[model samples]
Target chain A: MLSCKEVTHLLSEAQDRKLSLTESMQLKLHLMVCKGCTNFSAQMDFLRRACRGYLTRDTPRDDD
Target chain B: MTSDSPSSPRVTPETLAALRTDMLRFATLQLRDPHLAEDMVQDTMLTALNKADQFAGRASVKTWVFTILRNNIIDAIKLRARTVSASAYTAEGESLDAAFDTLFKDNAHWSPATRPVAWGDPEDALQDQQFWTVFEACMAHLPTNTARVFMMREVLELSSREICEDLSISMSNCHVILHRARNALRTCLQGNWFTASGCATC
Candidate 1:
């Protein structure tokens, strides 16, 4: 199993590129057993979605 | 003055005003330079106005405007990269490297503070006005090129190779910067928003 540190790095990397099959398998297997990494993955996903909202969502004008 | 598509939302002066305000805020957050962000938003709106007749209503007017602003952001990022290589930008930051090393043990297990807290509904938690205030603060804390590379990859959903081309960095360099960016942003956010209330959030 990948260490939690390595798995967290992979979780962040997975957002930007396609991990190879071996790498993907290793990450998945680790996340299946690691709650911290799993929560981190969810957190990263949420950040991405929040950014998407930031770009396109309408804002109420009149404040700094 | 244009013809009758009842389903298509009209783009009015007030609408553009609101959009310009939004685009400025969004651009400022990503670029973190209020002047440059202002310039980009100005350019985007000018282009939108010049090309208004060409908006075929395929997407909402806001979406159309945002797409333009997004491209504007990409151009600005590329321009900055040409002005300075991102690798050199990272060269002086030994602390970032040390920061990464400190996260793991000799066996590469996570150290205590680096462990992920079970954050709340990220989607909803981030939407809270106070939480977004903190989020922007964390984003503002990133190193310059690291922030650029990170937002391009994670926020704008650009591919790593695209980031490489844009930032004039190699693939591995892009990965390294992104790794640092994520760690720094996560650590900052965890300190501000996650720890005090656990997953209860801001």
Candidate 2:
């Protein structure tokens, strides 16, 4: 089983590259039981979406 | 003003000037230096104006101008990489590991105090202007190189291979920096935006 730390690292790597089948299976198994890791995964997805949103909204309001 | 096509707005000084604030904000974030960002934006504007006639309607004028700015930022980053010592590029590696260590225990599990929590719906936060302000602040918190590389990958939409080559770092190194950057940004956001106590106004 991949440790939560390893799982998080793999989660980030999954964004950049494909994981091996074994790695994928391990990650899936870990995520099924790990609510924290699951939340972390969702946050990663949110971060990516936020970045895309940032790109499309070119003209940010001046109040910031 | 009478042109039927809306994709390509006429490249007038006003149109280009309107984009200056956003362009400067992007450049300033990547360069981490206001003066240099100003210069880069100036250069981008000049290049855009000089080649105004070549502005094809394939993409929005903002996109076209940004592409020019992106290229300029890339060149500037590459130039800086050449002049700075190779050691400087890797200075953040240790700190990144230390950051991860703080989040995870010796047994390689998340430290209970730092474990992730549900952030509720992200859409609401995305639509909030205060969320972007917090997001930019989190971005500003990153190490200079980490933020630059993150912007290159996420905002500029460059592939890892291209980033590795352009920054002259190994593929693994590039990945490590990117991972650290994401981790840092998320952690910051979780603290600042998601948690009730983190932001008084929000």
Candidate 3:
């Protein structure tokens, strides 16, 4: 099982899709058994999606 | 508006305007002050003109302007730091560390109203005015040096080596500052912008 610390870094990496397949599997396995981490992972995934959106958008204007 | 001068390369009117707009945004992101940002942009233009020979045509004109603007930002940060009270710095350090621990370690404890957005449509959320306000606020809360590193590395998208040279900090310190900056921004955005309600926050 991945410790909370490992999962934390994984979550950060998962956003950037920097995790390897093996690490992803391990993270998935750990999350299945850890409710708190499962929720945490879900939240990170959500944030990654949102921030990616921001990155893709045009340079924000001052008026907006 | 002329780059035709014998000593100074004529900077086209169009090129100057583009440079001004880009520098204004880049500098404003660092200082959060429009007036100061404009000044930095102007200074960058002046530098670029005076040292036109240094423009090896290596980096794009925009990148060159950004480099100068970032240097100005670091100088501004150092100036501000010098004036800040020691106690104020200490309090910021202590308080921000506690905030980082709380926000990054756990999410379930956060109120539902502040939960992460479902993130189904990032484009829609990106269009929201509230996002910029929250993003800027979270960025503003970071320690000065940390904020500078983050802006240069992430927002300005400069290389770590370039950031170190620009800020006059070591590579390790750049990593450390970037690490702390990312953590602090992540935590602040979560606590302040992610509305537990997970709705379109204005």
The candidate that wins on TM-score is 2
Query: Top DockQ: which candidate number?
Result: 2
Q: List candidate 1 stretches off by more than 4 Å.
A: B3-7, B197-202
Q: How large is the i-RMS for each model, in angstroms? A: 1.8, 1.4, 6.0
Query: Which residue runs of candidate 3 sit more than 4 Å off their true CA positions?
Result: A10-64, B1-22, B31-38, B47-93, B103-120, B160-179, B196-202
Q: Is candidate 1 or candidate 3 better by DockQ?
A: 1
What is the docking quality class of candidate 1? medium
Error of 1 at B183 (Å): 1.6
Task: Give the best candidate by lDDT.
Answer: 2
True contacts kept of each: 0.70, 0.79, 0.04
Q: Estimate each model's TM-score.
A: 0.86, 0.89, 0.55
The ten-residue window of minimal lDDT in model 2 chain B covers B193-202
- Candidate 3 local accuracy as lDDT? 0.58
Model 1, span B1-202: residue lDDT tens: 7775767776666567777767887798778889999888888888888888888777888888888888888888787776666546577345666776776778887667666778765666655777777777777777777777788887778988887877677887777788788777777777787774332111
Candidate 2 accuracy as lDDT: 0.83
Tens-place lDDT per residue, model 3, B46-134, is: 87777766766666666665667667777776565444443443454565555445544353233333323343443455577787667
Better of 1 and 2 by TM-score: 2
Please give the ranking of all candidate structures by DockQ, highest first, separated by commas.
2, 1, 3
